[model samples]
Target: MAGRGDIGVRIGLSAVIFVLDGPGLSVLTTHAQEVAPGLPFGPFDPTRHRTFELALRAFVTAQTGFRLGFVEQLYTFGDAGRDTPRAAPAGDPARQVSVGYLALTRDALAPPSADARWRPVESFFPWEARRAGRLPLIDEFLAPRLRAWADAEPGERRRRRVEALFALEDDAGWNEAAVLDRYELLYEAGLVAEAARDRPEPPAADDAPLLGQPMESDHRRILATGLGRLRSKLRYRPVLFDLAPETFTLSQLQAAAEAVSGLRLHKQNFRRGVERTGLVAPLGRTTTGTGGRPAELFTARLGAPEDGHAPGLALPALR
Candidate 1:
């Protein structure tokens, strides 16, 4: 058996790509391409690469033409059968490990072609609600399986799993930061495409849609990892500023936060949070109202840590 140290760590990158929201807070995308045809998996070229970060930047730019901004390491995925078989001579029975990263970019960048798409984040993770609505996707698909899993074992063990996974029993509330837990739950229930090959047949419609779009190999899972990181990071850190334009009205900044987080915010409360955080400095300018009164504009306070020290923004709080 291969020891833990013997595992091969292949340096690879995946972008949890996002774009600016339009009027009424609509999500957009610039680079939307299929993984296989655009980026084929092969040997990690050492000579042509200087560092992993540089290689990721180069790969994304070369493949989709979108320049990346505000990128951070998301997670590392390594499972025995995760990677597709390598080409003939390169065939090695070693597991492939991928280092995922999250990236934010402006929609000004055009995606390569039709094979790639920049659909809203809702298209995939429908459970992430931006409006004041319940996630039917979860109620319809995930809840049942989670209940089953919770009920599998009795006593404290079972109770804990249920509470941790579903936030049930005590109205403990859903912890949005548990992104990986949510994905893994869906995977174990065979609701996601990543584990499709392992199962004999397709799951019922209730479970089918929960998986969202299937990416090449485990790319979708990697993408999910990145998405989870981005969502949680927004709360404690000022990373959202990276996605905003230079000067933006308070409402525009809130919209940007909602677009990325997939949840709405209370207008007054959001303004208060921004003010308390002191992350945005007033621009001393105002813009005419979209329908009501004009609003003041501000820019994200720079020179502080990339990770800001604010009351982490939450999707539910905003809603």
Candidate 2:
């Protein structure tokens, strides 16, 4: 008989591959017919793969046909109920744990398989992207519902949390790095589909407010975790190069940053910030077909310096 320590624990691997697709940050996804799309995921077979990262890379490449670069381990999601429709197949161990990884690329390739796709990141959390000035869903649907949820609590805890995470009230400010926090809060308040998926009685359509499109199982939550981590890391690291082409104009670089953060950055201020970091050098090449004026091309420095300075300028305070 197997001992307690010998219980089979299924090891799964998932990848949240971020690409700077046209006008936005996109994620590589796979669909299991009739179910929501999810990150490229597969089981980790120790016999076939030497390491967790290698296993994840293999699975994602097999699913999306796009090789990943600049990969990093994001987090481990082992919650008991996280394995949804894709729960271990018959005769497999009942226990499961998934190791999540983050990968960045400059291009979103056409999927080799019919079920794979490159989806816009904002589709999973529409409220996170601010490119369209202001999203009506947040103002007309999310705010009122969140306020009601906060007020229902007898103590000040939930209310304060709502204010902090969503930047409610006059003085509170939005924190771009709070992506996961905001998503989890919405889930707790029963405003997202995943929360309803787990509940015995799902909320009415009016109550759930179609928070973007849902992913299969808890994959959306894992994507949120990756986004939050990447947002926070951008402040201290020169990791954005992983998502940039070998050569690009300053305007192009700034646009990439804006797309990832979902905020418009002041052109002059952003350029100044980039200059101060000394992270890019002239490539001695220029593009003349911009239709306005010739633009100089630049390449990212070989290494990201850690000088204890806040990266790029923070968004101008929101009014």
Best by lDDT: 2
Candidate 2 lDDT score at position 280: 87
Q: Which stretches of candidate 1 lie over 4 Å from their true place?
A: 1-10, 23-43, 85-94, 112-115, 153-159, 167-170, 200-210, 305-319
- Worst 10-residue stretch by lDDT in candidate 2? 310-319
lDDT value, candidate 2, whole model: 0.80
Q: Which ten residues in a row have the lowest lDDT in candidate 1?
A: 23-32
Tens-place lDDT per residue, model 1, 1-319, is: 7686684545455556666646322222222333332122233457888776777777666655556676676777676666552221356545666666667765544466443445555555566553554566566566676677667667676556556765544445666556666666667766666667556675555624445654556765665676777778888777777777888898888888877766656878888878877788998888886566888878877564555434455443531
- Cα distance off (Å), candidate 2, residue 144: 0.7
**Model 2 bad stretches (over 4 Å):** 1-7, 85-87, 90-93, 204-208, 304-319
**Deviation from native of the Cα of residue 292 in model 2, angstroms:** 2.2
| Residue 231 in model 1: lDDT | 75
Q: List, residue by residue over 1-319, the lDDT tens digit for candidate 2.
A: 8886674678788888888997789988898777888888889887899999888777777777778878989898888766443635855655778888988888776778898888898889888876555557777788888888889889989988887887666565668788999999999988888888888887656734558788887899899999988877777777788887889898888888887887667788778888877878998889975566999999987553465553543443233
- Model 2 clash pairs are none
